[model samples]
Target: MSDLGLDDLAAELADFAPAKKKQATYTAREERIIAGFEDIERFYEEHGRLPQHGEDRDIFERLHAVRLDRLRELEDCRTLLAGLDKHALLDRAAVVSMDEDDLDPDDLMAELSGLGEGDDITTLRHVRSAEEKRAAEEVARRDKCHDFEKFEPLFKQVKDDLANGSRITRPFELKAEIRPGAFFIVFGQICYVAEMGEVFTNPQGRTDARLRVIFDNKTESGMLMRSLQRQLNEDDAGRRITDPAPGPLFADKADDGEAETGTIYVLRSKSDHPVVAEHREVMHKIGVTSGSVEARISGAEKSSTYLLAGVEIVATYKVYGVNCQKLESLMHKVFASAQINLSIPDRFGHMVKPREWFLVPLHVVDEAVERIRDRSILDWVYDPNAGRLVEA
Candidate 1:
């Protein structure tokens, strides 16, 4: 097609108005057909040959046939455009006119001839290859489930010790499974338990929590947990904890509504603890929550020591299609500069549980312990108020 003729056709196509009722019905597929013809014309101009028939047959028949097919397929579209009142046509035409530069007559004709649609065309071969790499990584992670069973005895031992009142030594670490669950123990009685949700306490008396461990029945996570709970209950007769009861631990309380079982665990410092005062200050600065917070203090062994403190608080969050990578990245940055050592299992330490929880351990020396004594982390550890971290 001549450039001027193609331009005139494009202008006509652009001006072709769709009826209000039919405008919403125009599918992407239909638009692709329109765009395909435009591309075919462009291809012909570039190579000096029609796409399908090439220079063998007269170009007019090929062009006419394609246009006729498009017109038939777009009969409803054309009717809709024609039926539009003058004002509506002018309004729609203004927008379509702007897209005139995007039209390709060759592509449009190709779509009409049932060769190909312009919208279906993709040149991102590399993007598809990259997606394959990510898929492979996910498969590896799934297959590499470390043997958590071996740590069972150690967990029992630590739980027993904690039950008997042990002053967990500083910088101590061990991997164990505590009968009902598996956990990484650090600094004696202190343990980092990866349950159904993410919970952490800081040395300066702060807490941070996320939707990792806890389930919200009303939420998508809650539904998955409920299903998993049912499957687990069916798989093991003795392992079932409850008959999928709705509680705060498993679901969030409705707005302005109370939960049948309270899930929120609030940590408060004791009066005698000096860290309590510091915790209150930190809490004010970074909004304390029973769900999320971690505090750290350094400079204990030196006489001229400086108190270094940091807290991992969840600032803002968004749920995007079952992926918790964003939340994990946020938690990693929160603890990045804290200088506290987290006791993680060799197998599960680096791995986050499917339920979306984290096991974090906070450490401090004896002298600087005062810096965190009244702090919220200690309050959480020594006297876990409302949450299930410490058994009543």
Candidate 2:
């Protein structure tokens, strides 16, 4: 050692360095057999019985039976599972066998690809776990609404309130914003959260609540709070029904569509009449016009919609890709419940009821326009008492 050079000493040290262990790899077939066996083990744990085959049994159980049979036929599979075969499932006789040359090349490639991608080959065969079965049931339960008669009148009242200008829908907010009385649409069914339990941490550490959710068709479910939230967030069609409020529907500036289509305007009459002066805040004239609002209201004293007097524009929403006539009609319908019920004389001295006159708050009109903008107005109706939009 004393006679050795630096390079010789380094070589000796390298020889004592720890050897790097190579990774263990399995052939495609070996990987597939292991995955198949794991599925069987899980199935046994959940069902408390071995998967069986029969025309009356579930297809998934039959597939499991077939998979088990194939695994037992392969000696290599049994050898690989020797340590993991605590259930002695691999001690059975071979039920089926095929030569390597007998399988179609494409079929073999697909099987290998399915294994590598971790796709459960049994999934296509209608094999499902407990969670999967629950999800399927959720999707299929949309049609049943027990005691729907109790909810039918509620729907009717909402339509009346929507027509009367008492309720409006706004964009939904999350969590703290969603309370016990809120409504939502998930998986295409309108759901109402009748009550909420205390907020608590879920298994994933996210905040959750216990909710009693009533569906539109009369069915109800007591689901975890965030469970509904998760469904809403993950489902493409999930939407919350904004709580109705007494303020403007939307306080934002007019959108770009106003330039192309027309403006949906909320107006308060400047008439000093006792009726108009008393209910000033509640009474409004909601209308749509393709032309300038200022110019349109220039001869306010001559028209019945303006209450035969000059009017102040309280709010205006620019609409795009809309039929102004149809929009005006919709607005008129929304406030029909709150109609002023007064007759005004035109320049010709003919008295006529001002159809556009509504006793709704200015903010309600604004929110209604927002619903129209989002194309959700058609699916919602106002609930005057609840002060929110409910599913139509």
Candidate 3:
């Protein structure tokens, strides 16, 4: 068989489009086969070699095997390709104007009617049966209820506190206050508190008895209220006052304030702020990873035995176009600037000792290699090399 014929066959198979119905029916395995064939064909053109096969097989058998494998892969690709094509067609169809000749409303209605009223009735019956079964299961589950007696006291306490107009204070010094006849409660955060009035109401014009609020202590001020009705049921009773501290109370503010009419004062906690907490965590993490190297050398004598090992100094495009001699000279200058010592061995051969050495973490060496991997390099000097700089 001619190789050209096989190539043409492969191309034709790849370009072939399946019908919509057939596309939907295509298996995932079939699509994978088509994809494999395409890869194999591209490989054949690039490397001029076929996939590995039994040496004992003749050319015809080898080609047959390859074609069979490619066909399987093509089937898989075709399924996915067909789905993409269908989606593209659908998108195009969405923007296109529907012609009257292409669609008949009456015909569609007649076709739908052909499905039969009995079919709809049967479907409804099945749906109702499922719903009934679910309801029965739910009722049975309710009958097998777990004992909540242990949690009754805690739940009762929360209910009683809300009914008694009590407040709960959070760690951030924010307070949530529950008021009588209130649908929603208010809470203070930072210097301010949020108030909710007439928020929850029943359709019959009755307000909810329970009120709850959750607030963080990191908000603005000016959201407290006073109740005119003291005894709720009693006529002409004494009023109850609830108020937050006035305007921008900073942490540095004093406790003393001028007596204002109908005003109340609330103090903030002396706890560290969020920003301070975050800064402390960051410093802790850094200290755990890299102990303060600069702090260790502070106030040290000049004659102290300080050995700095594993100093990795990497340069990338810095020496790109420059010759080795210039590179060495530049490196020596950098070392001198960094206050690092430099040494070169006599009787130089192909390699030379690095011009400078300083102590650095092993991780730093890995980081430098990763950064300059794409750049031009004459040599990779990891260890100390001693020799006179030679021109590259």
> Per-residue alpha-carbon lDDT of model 2 for 1-392, expressed as tens digits?
37889998889899898998897687544554575687678777878777764322333344466667666656667788887777776775422221221121222121111111123332212222443344446644444557667765664454343333354222245766567777665543457776898888877888888877777545777777776776666543355644444432322345554436567888888888789999998788787766678877776675555666788888987766444545676676665566667865545565555566777776677677778656677776655566555676
Window of ten residues with lowest summed lDDT in model 1: 93-102
Taking the tens digit of each residue's C-alpha lDDT, what string does model 1 give over 45-123?
A: 5555433321112333243334333433554544544443222321221111111111223222211112233323211
Model 1 lDDT at residue 10? 78
Residue lDDT tens for model 3, 1-392: 64568778878787676645642453333332333344345444545544332222222223323343333344444444444442232122111111221121221121111111232211111123443343233222322113334433433343333222242212111112334322221110011112345544556674433222221111122222222111111211111222321222111222355321111111111113343233322111000001123332232222011111211112222112112222232233322322223222222121222222233223333333333333322333323232121223
Worst 10 contiguous positions by lDDT, candidate 2 = 108-117
TM for every model, in the order presented, reads 0.14, 0.33, 0.11
lDDT of candidate model 3 versus the reference: 0.26
What is the descending TM-score order?
Answer: 2, 1, 3
Candidate 1: residue 269 Cα off by (Å): 4.7
Quantify all predictions' global Cα lDDT against the true fold: 0.27, 0.59, 0.26
- Error at 320, model 3, angstroms: 42
Model 2 reaches what TM-score against the true structure? 0.33
